[model samples]
Target chain A: MRIKVKFHSLLRLYLGFGEMILELPDRQDITVRELIDELNLRVGKELKNKLLDGDEIKKGTMVLLNGKNILHLKKLDTVVQDGDVVVFFPPGGGG
Target chain B: MKSELSMFQRQIELLGTDCQSKIADTVILVAGIGGLGSVVAESLVRFGVQKIYIVDNGLIDAPDLNRQILYTYKDIGRPKVLVAKERLSSINPSCEIVPMDEKISESFELPNDVDGVADCLDNFADRFTLAELAWNKGIFLVHGGINGFWGQITSIVPNKSPKMKDLFAGVDEERQQVQVIMPTSGIVALLQSLEIVKLICGIEPNLIGKLLLIDLLNYDFDKIEV
Candidate 1:
């Protein structure tokens, strides 16, 4: 299965890429948590620490699955299917 | 009536007499008279809104002058809501300006007549509180936020869209004081005011259940379905 992930704002600065497509093996269902672990290997620890806290996604970072927030679904445990579009960005809090 | 129409001839032409009348009859609440609120409040008045309720508990300081256009150096120690009320009144005397020098929290109560609420707060907790208040009241909420060259705007129509809290569930509740550019704040606030006007005028709002992400640094504008 393949999924498209897009980064925005500070996440793009941290990862150095606006978007990427990941090809995962089709034998097993992949959750958002496993996907983040895979992303950590490619983006390095500095970016990983900003996004994750002990396997759970860090607060202030929004993870959207196919444009719908994953938090409304199942947090990091939300299932991702083929061709799903995932987006990660930190919403600005300042007025 | 003819004389009054001349004051808003340009906007009346664009929105038509019926829609312009609707705008003139709407009442809006603007939370936080700071960066975004300042501009949103002013735009509402200029657009012929019937009344505006402005809330802010903070006092004007030197740092606020960078993006808070409603304040001047002489207003450094004055309450922001009062300053905004005085300024907005002078801009459009017929529009009623209700100023509240109070902070919005879980215990805050909105007036019964408010048609729409603008969440221009500087923190997520207050934004969440405002959103909940609007949701409970069954009114529209226009939300705006800015950090540096990035900002976002969205409208929440009660019962039709997801709550702001549910959409931003994992966001940190702590206030992160960020450096926001003046133009970015101005742009976001204007967009918020536009949403409010569209809502009151019975036009199809562009951001219901959608988020408009603005990246001024990269000159990119994208809409994401929520």
Candidate 2:
């Protein structure tokens, strides 16, 4: 299975890349948490910390699975299917 | 004072008399009279909104002049709510400007008559609080945030779309002051005001159940459904 991942705002700056396609071994299911673990490996530790804090998604960072917020679903445990487009971006905090 | 029709002649031409009356009959709450709130309140006044409830506890500082257009150099050191009331009243004396010099917190109470809310708060915590208030009241909320060249606007209709807190879960409240460019703030603020007007006029808002992400630095505008 393959999923397209896109980064925005500071996440793009931290990762140094905007988008990528990750080929995961075909499986019955892959949750967003599992994908983040894979992403942490690719993007390294520094950026991983920016996205997560001890397994919790960092505050201000938004994770959208196929444009829907994963929090509205099952959060980090939300399932991601093949070809799903995942987006991670931090909505600016300042008014 | 200008004739009622003539006062909003330009917008009346665009929205028609019925829709303009809907806009005039609605009451909006604008939280935080700073970069985004200042402009959103002013636009509401200029658009002939009948009433606006503005909340803010900050005083106008010199640095705010870069984006808070409602205040002038003379307004520095004065309470922002008072200045915002004075300026918005001058823009449309007939429009009621109810200013509350207070901060939004868990206990903040929204007026029962408010038809919509504009979340112009600077931090995620306050924004989340405001969203909860809107959801509890079952009113529409238009949220806008900006930092430097990045900004986002989204309209949340309670029970119809994702909650603001759900979208921004785990996001830490900004501890330090964040950089905000004047133009970017103005653009996002106007978009929020536009959403409110569309809500009142029965027009489908652009960002309902979606987030409009803007990157002025790279000139990219993306709308992501949520």
Candidate 3:
């Protein structure tokens, strides 16, 4: 299974560009945290902390699956399947 | 000379005589006469809004020239509220343009008769302050926010709507950490202005309780439930 991931704002500085696709094992579903961990392992440490803190997100970025926000849905434990599009946007506070 | 109202003939036809009259008589308060506010204010005046109150404590700088369309080379170093008022008034002299000439602070008080508010401010402190003030007054506040090809617009109807703070828990402190995009501001402000018009005309807004999120890069428009 494959899912698309996005990084925005300073996270973009760490993760670079806007979005990418990841290949995950089919039939082995993972929570949002596990996905970030996978990204951290692949992208390195500096990028992981920007999106995840300790065991949770930094509370600044808005993680959206499809068009719905993850917070309103299931926080980090939200399950991701094949072809799911996950967006991580650190909302700019400048307006 | 053609009637300046001619530009709004199509809109008047849709709103009819009664609602059109109401829209014309309505006054809007725009907090932060920069990026978003400037475009919102300009569009309102062009659409024949009778009066507008622009509040801002910012000055025109070199960096704002990109999307702050109301200002120019000559207007540089001038107060944003003053310049915006001057430009909007020139665009439609029949309408009244009030310059609040101040920052959005704890003391900000909304006029009782203000028809609506456009939250085009650049900082969350001001945005939150103005939203809270408008909500307390039971006024319609159309919030517009944008950054890096992403933007969202929501209409806050005070007690009847979800509080802005509830949707965005702690974005105030993270203000400086975010990125600002030029096109996003214009698009968001246009949507915000349209929301204001719909509110004044007693029409249903698409963004009443929902946030319209636009991802320009992907050309995808999605709504996030507040």
Give me the displacement of residue A74 in model 2, in angstroms. Answer: 5.0
**TM-score evaluated only on chain B, model 3:** 0.93
Give one digit per residue, the lDDT tens place, for model 2 in B54-96.
9999999999999999999998899999989999998778899
Best-to-worst ranking by DockQ: 1, 2, 3
Tens-digit lDDT string for candidate 1 (B142-199): 9998888889898988877779998878888778888887899999999999989888
Best by DockQ: 1
TM-score of chain B of each: 0.97, 0.97, 0.93
The candidate 2 chain B region of ten consecutive residues with least summed lDDT is: B167-176
In model 2, the Cα lDDT at residue A74 comes to 90
lDDT of 3 by residue, B1-226 (tens): 2686686788778778777777788889988887888899999987778989888888899888888889998888999888887888888888899898887889878977787899987767677778889888778888887776777788888766677766665353434534556787788888888888888877774677776766676666666555
Task: Report clash pairs, candidate 1.
Answer: none
Better of 1 and 3 by DockQ: 1
Candidate 3, which segments miss by more than 4 Å at Cα?
A1-35, A38-47, A64-87, B1-4, B172-181
Alpha-carbon error at B31 in model 1, in Å?
0.3
Q: Give lDDT: candidate 3, residue B168.
A: 60
Alpha carbon lDDT of residue B201, candidate 2?
85
